[model samples]
Target: MKILNLFFIGLLVSISSLASAQSDAEIEKMIVELHKPTKKISDSIGKLMQETKSKIETEIDSVVKENLKLRSDTLFNAFDDNAINELKQDFVFAKKYPNSLAALKLLRRHVNRFIGMNFYDTYVEVFQNFSPEIRNSEKGKEMAQNLQYFKQSKVGSTAPSFSLVDSNGKTISIDDFKGKQYVLIDFWASWCGPCREELPYIKELYKKYHQQGFEIISVAKDDKQDLWKKAIEKEQIESWRHIFTSEDNKNIIKNYNVNGIPHKVLIDKNGIIIGKWKGSGENNKHDLQQLLKSIFEAE
Candidate 1:
């Protein structure tokens, strides 16, 4: 793995050198060429590993031995930490054997740990460095397009004010909840899976703490009234206010830089954004609850 790290570091350096050249065509050509051999090797190893279960142990051993030799010949000669880390992450020895998926999962866990320890860049940098094609990819595009909203939602920044019609069509603004010690302006839609999954927990939290000066103002982005109504009724989400942002209202979405559904912004009574933005699931509820507890206790 260390050797593999060195190999990739060398490769990145080699590629970086070509960046000074003015030709996009040349750079594209080089990217293709450089990625080709590694792709072939990776594909072959993946295929063999997928079939390794039916093979004898001796045959597996032989394959492993051959791969190590190939790796030594191609990768071990390099000496770059970042490159080596990338290569090791991309290729693990256990990937050649049966039950490789488990091994690969473990390898991924370790790789994530390593990256978390060393690369503490914010999510913006992480997304920016991703391949350009990623933005065109389905989920990638959604995230990329919404990056502005997420980035603007900083702790000290002013929470964007909006006047959205509630279920009964009355317009309301952030000022309505002004006196509350904490307010969670959750942006969601009726059709979102993660939002639906989070409803029960959110309801529980809301009910448990609403009297303590915590208010949850839910704004749905659903275009259809019936489905939105059905979800609210079914989920029994009795928050402080349940408002729906009109589908045609591009300004609100653009103002918050909301690119994804189920987005949330927690604002303190003083109107400072405090909690992390949540786009999906119940993952952040526990943290939010803890924060609320602390706030209430402090007050």
Candidate 2:
């Protein structure tokens, strides 16, 4: 009897161990099922992110196309005198597409080009009122530079000093004539037609006022020394000192802020600039003559 009871006790112990092993395997399977759902959720999120990105790109492309079309239409309508007015009207449309990079680019281009066509003061006012970040952009830098250069080219500013070699290879500096009553600094080129046309009038003025302490300094922006000499001879501009500068000489040009040819600066004896003349129009000639006469009378 005792042997039979021991055998039964051992059999019961083995059965209990088998039941515990089965329970552990079932728990592991439950854990794996929970992890499977997590992986599915992760994959779903990734697919959704890709779809969202594609949608955003497609929308951006569509906005760009529309903005380009609008710009084209606006430019086409800008052929008339009412171009500025039309541009102002289209600015409302540009504002509507705020935050669109394509629209902002188009708006900036049109605004900058329009500013070039009008008063610089107005441009400055408008640009200053714009978004600060946008105004500091690369395009904005160029616009500001243009405005500054234009402002510096105005009359009554101190004429920039320069030194160049005369026809005899003697160095001449604008400061050399500082003690005189007045000085006329003329920028000319051998190939400039208007400069040649104005030579006779300049000669007349020099001959009349030269003895009265008036001096003329003609600076030639010429690449060829022979052509420059020939022009000086042909024009009979002998009373004035003639000097030539090389084609690559940018310092003088930048100092004067000269963008066009036939520019003249009138300076007082104290090295202070009094007036400026630009271009070769009839109005410019008349203005120059009047100014010279006024200066002579004042002296």
Candidate 3:
């Protein structure tokens, strides 16, 4: 009886061990099946990422090519409905996709020409609408610089302050004239014919109004100091202040929007730009003369 009981217990132990081994094998097989689908999902994600990258590169290249065509001088100079339409489209693209590389590139490349062609307001509006990431980029910074004059030097805006060396090696600044006198800021070059022609009229105005709290600040764009001094002496009008736009000071030209020589800005005693003239002619002279007469002769 004892031998039979021991044999029965041994049989049951063997059966339990076999059952445990089979359960482990089944779990291993389930793990392998789960990993098969996971591997396929990972491979699909990698392929999708590569395709997305390639598509972005292609789009960037296409945009750059189109921009090159739009930047041509002929297209900008056409000044017709087609040119206007093209510009309008560019503006629309930039406004709608402010963060796009192509939009930023377009504004950076065409900002100067757009301002020159009298699209200043529109250019400014577009630039202001860009995202901070776009506006703070290197190209965006350059665009903002190009728009400086249009934004700061317009009529009814305060004149941008700057400093330059006078003939005596003395530094003079636009702020020096503020609150003390009404100032006429003249932008002239020694080689400019129109500037030379306007000298007599400027001198006459200075002589007539110098004692009445009026002052003239002549800013020369001369390449040579001797020529500038000679012109001053030959004209015998050195009674007023003279400033040379030296290499470091040439930015003043851009600040005042000196599109052409013989440009003049008239500022009141409080430093407000009261008048501006671009070129030398009877009409400009007449305008300046009348403005001065109205101010000093008002009393």
Candidate 4:
């Protein structure tokens, strides 16, 4: 049993590692080897395991084929204008196959794109189309929890509040900025490459807007305090308030729907969220900068 298990595990790993580079026939052969039935097991248990293994292999193959098709899809490649059509198709697939792992994987892969493009309502609809059993699965539970956080960080929702120790050892909360200044709650970490790349641009925004009742509260997700402080000093962004997430304070990440860094939430003086940006893409940077200009320049 041990040798058989190890042989199957090795085959699965080989399939995964070579799937992208393998020809369709070669990939199929590897998948077949991965799920091949063992002669050592009793007939009844072997039959059951074979059925389960066949189902899992089918799911994996379907997902892989769909992904390969997507790689060559020109319309989906264009993305900005044609993404909605593809997303609609994915939603249809999800609804039709409510319990399919392949369907769930497709949804999970595109969720960030959906959220980024302001199609959050459609994303929720897709989630609702899944079966109750699928919805209660572990992955489904995570998606459900994330949906609540997304609602809290929606553009019109009030910013979620939190208190954490700052670089100067002072306790700071989003509530402290309410009625006094517009705030940008930035979720980042010391080790994230994209987060490090955006720090200089953010520093300029802080410097430009600080006098105009603008403030930044950078929430570091670093597990190590020294790394957080070192990154701050290295980036020369010590002027803005800095804090880190800990086992005790990590709920701040969930409270803001921070699926990825560097996630940012912009709030007005009254604490109403004006914008929520994720990732370190050029478009995100431009949008945040343009909105800042509109607010402060108008005043």
Which of the numbered candidates is closest to the native, going by highest TM-score? 4
The segments of candidate 3 whose C-alpha lies over 4 angstroms from its true place after superposition are 1-122, 129-139
Q: How do the residues 192-235 of candidate 4 rate in per-residue lDDT, one tens digit apiece? A: 99899898899899999999999999998887898988999999
> Among these predicted structures, which one has the highest lDDT?
4
Worst lDDT run of 10 residues, candidate 3, spans 72-81
TM-score of each: 0.53, 0.57, 0.58, 0.69
lDDT of 2 by residue, 1-299 (tens): 99999999999999976775575455445435634644465456455545544554465578765654444333333332244544454454335433333333434454334223334455455556546555676766665676565555445555567777777778877788888668887889989998988888888888888888889888888888899998888888877788776665557776765656788878888787777766664555677788888888677
Residue-level lDDT for 189 in candidate 1: 86
Q: Between prediction 2 and prediction 4, which has the larger lDDT?
A: 4
Q: Can you write out model 3's per-residue Cα lDDT over 1-299, one digit (the tens) per residue?
A: 89999998998898876775575455445435634554465455455545544554465577764544343322223323343455666677568766554566655555543223446788889898988977887877877887886667766779888877788878888799888899999889788987987899899999899999889989998999889999999888789889987778888888886767778889987788888776655556778999999999995
Question: What lDDT would each prediction earn against the true structure?
Answer: 0.60, 0.65, 0.73, 0.75
Candidate 2 clashing pairs, residues 3+ apart or interchain: none
TM value for model 3:
0.58
Clashes of 3: 0
Ranking by lDDT: 4, 3, 2, 1
